[model samples]
Target: MEDSYRHKGMRRQLVKVVRSKGIKDERVLDAIGKIPRHFFFENALVEHAYQDKAFPIGAGQTISQPYTVAFQTELLNVKPGDKVLEIGTGSGYQSIVLLELGAEVYTIEYQKELYERTRFALPEMGYKANFFFGDGSLGLPRFAPYDKIIVTAGAPTVPDALIDQLKVNGCLVIPVGNAKTQQMLRLTRLEGNKLRKEVFHDFKFVPLLGDDGWKK
Candidate 1:
């Protein structure tokens, strides 16, 4: 519960690990250092919180590995005051990182349990985000045209709805592939609704569930 000196030290080591893994964004690494990842885990798993690995956070979702979080965030190229729509809240760790970078985050969670838990937990940790519960694949049309969109789950393909919600010149980061593993993709929305796609490393994530995602 407490972010002690030891926890801060652990986070510094994590930053180094993430940096070694090629996350060169200083802002992203700094945000990772400030957020207390252990706060998202139970007491039993707290010891391993700073490790660069995913841990289950109930509802069949896992807190994403720190490296993956940094990787996706760096690809987003988030700017201060950017309107970022996150497709999966999960443990809310990714949202917190974005908030630390001065982003106006609006995050959607699919599982009711995880959503309810994070809806209260994040603010308690001094992080604020607009939280919604529903099918993230549908995207949040009410608040469309986001400057950045990040999907935290693995999808069979990029959802068209997400691309539609992005503003011109906006960026989207997602993992696309089968249920087992996914290829990280960054899409920059160009003029005329065209997208510039770039593929990065591969990662494993929970299935993105919804009509536009993997079928239930």
Candidate 2:
């Protein structure tokens, strides 16, 4: 788990790439710049870590493109100490980003292998979040009412459970569409449980699998 100066330099360049792609939130950009993404990859594939592209992280999941991660994090509008729920922990990269933003994160992963791997890996990298192994599409109901929620996989539709878990004025950022591609959506929970929905960029993500998502 070595993050050499060369890796830090690559991260700086990666930040420039994401910033150029219209990620104006300096906090988001800073997180993108600070995280050692190479630590999430195997030594052989570390070179691909800062390329602004999504790469395989086993279990049929991806680490997501850097711009996409920044995009969603920007939409989340995290405040320091906000309680954030993250679906599809994947390689735990996004969780770290949320952590860097000063959010208390509760992240869940559906794939057992990824769940186990990230549960151990993140803390070892000096990043920690409350990790759970379960169907993320169902959200985490026991800890309902999060200040923000982010889903890393593509869903057929926005899961009701996630919306229900958001606090009033809270935000949930997810990509909703078919298995191949999804439209990035931001839903802000409003008074009376209503929502203000806004849609943004199209992205391709691995299918979200669970009771409320695509069937296994």
How far does residue 95 in candidate 2 sit from its true spot (Å)? 0.2
Question: Model 1: what TM-score?
Answer: 0.98
Q: Compose the digit string of candidate 1's lDDT tens values, residues 8-54.
A: 99999999999998999999999999999998877787789999999
In candidate 1, which residue ranges exceed 4 Å CA deviation?
Answer: none
- List residue ranges in candidate 2 displaced over 4 A: none
Q: In each prediction, how many residue pairs overlap at the backbone (N, C-alpha, C within less than 3 A)?
A: 0, 0
lDDT of 2 by residue, 1-216 (tens): 777899999999999889889999999999998899998887888889999999988888889999988999999999999999999999999999999999999999999999999999999989889999999999999998899999999999999999999999999999999987899999999999889999998999899999989989
TM-score of each: 0.98, 0.98
List per-candidate RMSD values in Å: 0.7, 0.8
